[model samples]
Target: MRKFIQSIMLLALSAQLFAQSSDWVYATMTHESALSLQSSHPSGIVILATEGNVSAVQIQHQLAPSLKSGNLHGPGYIYRTDAQDAVQALTKNAPKKFNILDFTITEDMFVNEVLGMVSQENLGNTILELENYGSRFHTTSSGRQAALDLKEKWQEMAQAANREDITVELFQHQLTQQRSVILTIPGTEVPNEIVVIGGHLDSGDWSLQTNAPGADDNASGIATMTETLRILLAKNFHPKRTVQIMAYAAEEIGLVGSNEIATQYNNQNKNVVAMAQFDMTNYNGSSVDVGLINDAQFTSSELNLFWVELMEHYNSTGEHRITYGTTACGYGCSDHVSWTENGYLASFPFESSFGEHNPFVHSEEDTFAAMNNDASHSVKFVKLALEFVIEIAKVSTMSTQELNKTDIQIVVQNRDLIYQFNSSNKSLNSMAIYDSSARNVLSKNQLNASGRISLQGIPSGYYIAVFKDNQGKSHSKKFLLK
Candidate 1:
């Protein structure tokens, strides 16, 4: 009976191991690639699917070295987990808990710090430079070079900001020499809880060593995210949770780089609060300014709802009024799926709907010019990305003393500023909106009995929302118009 029980346990372990779907993945390599010999796969390995039984660490050591120098047609290769397989493996028997929204939105100081920092000129320049790289096909020399260049660029930006807390790193993967660039801002309070914003850096035209500018396909995403980082650094915005900005490598071929990174993070039980992805963000192909991907298989509904609420609050009353809609990009179409499969909340905000997406992507025609030589559309994404970070990371300390004194909740609703006072003891005598320089932009001397104050014709900026209570106490809250 003891021997039978032991055999039963062994059978159960074997069943679990074999049933792991993430182990069944695909490799993009020809028969001549060195990875072919290392893989237990048969010949003619063009997009071959294999089930790897090795540990993550063992796989990295066994496969990563040989992958350092190969192209699609040469002795190198790129590998990625099968999208469906990964999703199945990770979600099997997983609880369907909708994580509670547990964050506050108050950071006018951080908002003010970012003004004039997300430069359209700078964004255009970054896109142009990346386009000039000719191609960033995962296995090509230019691809690796582009990744290294981006790493250096981020490092310079951090140094220029004189921020020692920000560390830019190259996250190496086993698929290609191209390493993902990671910029981390360690949280002042909860450093372990993380918020991530990502975009893919590599571009391709379904061929290696080709001129795939991919300006709209992904350079726009990277440039927009870069601006977000620059502004955050410029403002010296410190949050309660770590904020990570990522530029993924080899995304055009498969979700290779991000898959490895997300898997490692999951295995280590990292507390990733949320992840937002920016991809193909420049081309305004649709009527809406942004399209939040609603694919249930590849996105988090709870997190996406937060984004909708954020837009409704910020973009509703601002001069730069942003319009948004929901669309679906199929599973594993981008890197956000990598995080999603690993049981982390992720979102993808695309430039437009699927039917109206930039048509020139993954081709030589995907140039900066293809995006009409404008970074205006992409600028909206930067705004959204920065706001996402602030909301998820939360403020380390309240910037306004009134926030501590009053139970008044403030938000923009339907192009009107609504201030909801929940405290029966607090009666508003007066209210005013002052710009960043403390200049009174809008003022009201009378307050209605309803305990709600609505204002209109206010522009987007950092402002001091000052309310005078009946007790003659001046309560002030820092407010961002959008």
Candidate 2:
């Protein structure tokens, strides 16, 4: 009788998973029960997990009203997974590896050139158009149309620049009607390395058919990225590593769109150097101009530090000084969390402190006109995003090439690294071999007196040979292993 009951339970679970639809909701009595849903259903992804009572609006946006109205409240979890096979694969249940790159920005000239191109006028226009769409709720027709419009605008901008290397694509999420917009500019040298800057295009309120202009909530982020793209094209800046600008869909709906995309990238083993999220950038809610989310559990601190230093370097004139501070936005607060959950280095440069986030979000009141119709605050993020891409991706220029031109010659033969540097004892202190993903594969200290070092059993791919001389200065050269 016990064996028969077990079989019956298993059969019931299968039925629940396979029969899930858009409107279906799985309300678990306990946290353990909620996790079981992930294993059973294809789209059995968690949308909410609160210890205390949650707002009626929050429940209405993520859970079925009928179920919540029936008093199915939870200290457990709420899942909206119906048909999300791809998303399921990307979800990491435990801690994972974060791929870190070793590139540094030493070019002040290049940084200045990019910062000059940010335009408040252009950002203002982009925000105006997005707000005109009324609402961008994931399941609504208006949301779908906004995504399509964004894709076209990005494609046209790339075309006008005559950049054949840039490709604009729409990543479809089958569970929802809207698709994510991705603009990829392949690296001139290291095409495998990637840097991502993104914002959600979809916005929402309690009423799906009503207005949710979302000017500060996210249209600001999208417009900032768009203006950043325009500046990159105008300057003809081609980076050594690929840079992608993404406008995610359904971010307001539990980060649904970005989670799917990040999962796919992880499954493909793509080497993403860093990802920056710009959500709610227009409103100057806090005294500080920029808020770097210090969510240690959800963001990369190393990258956050880099943002601070970069802003400091540009703030010498005081006019562009971005008064900034750090604060946490909790887990899964924005789309950047999606990438962080997938073991990627992601950072969120939020607009204000969490407590001070625009109260107009997720409402019809979220319009540019409502924020006093100013783009100055949002422009700071636009400049930062632009610099973040160029610096992290590292544009290929004559100066960079010249810096790598040294007497040290490196060659690879028979899966071994051959190097020759004069006066290895006093001049050279240590040598290290790093893979394209910036993982240190091998290290050696105190070179031989002959000044010739040969390493064996190296894998076939592009590698960076970094040598630190007595002066404490490091120089890196890229070599291919056949």
lDDT per residue for candidate 1 within 191-274, as digits (tens), equals 999999998888873443478787876889899989988888776778889999999987765577887888788878888888
Encode model 2's per-residue lDDT on 1-482: one tens digit a residue: 34643553454356455444433433222233333434454253443332222210111224321222222111122223532321232233534444333645555577676776678888889999999988887777888999998999989999999998899999988556799999999998999989999988887733444677788778999999999898888988888889999998877655778878887898888888899998888888898888788766567765765665566556524456777777765334678877876788889988887668777776678889888888888889988997789878887864765553454666766666677765544577788876533347799898642254555666676566777667655555566666
Question: Candidate 2, after superposition: displacement of residue 119 in Å?
Answer: 1.3
Assess each prediction's global lDDT (C-alpha) against the native: 0.67, 0.69
TM-score of each: 0.69, 0.70
Looking at model 1, which ten-residue stretch has the lowest summed lDDT? 53-62
Model 2 CA deviation exceeding 4 Å by range: 1-101, 206-209, 401-482
For residue 381, give model 2's deviation from the true position in Å: 0.4
Q: How many clashes show up per model?
A: 1, 2
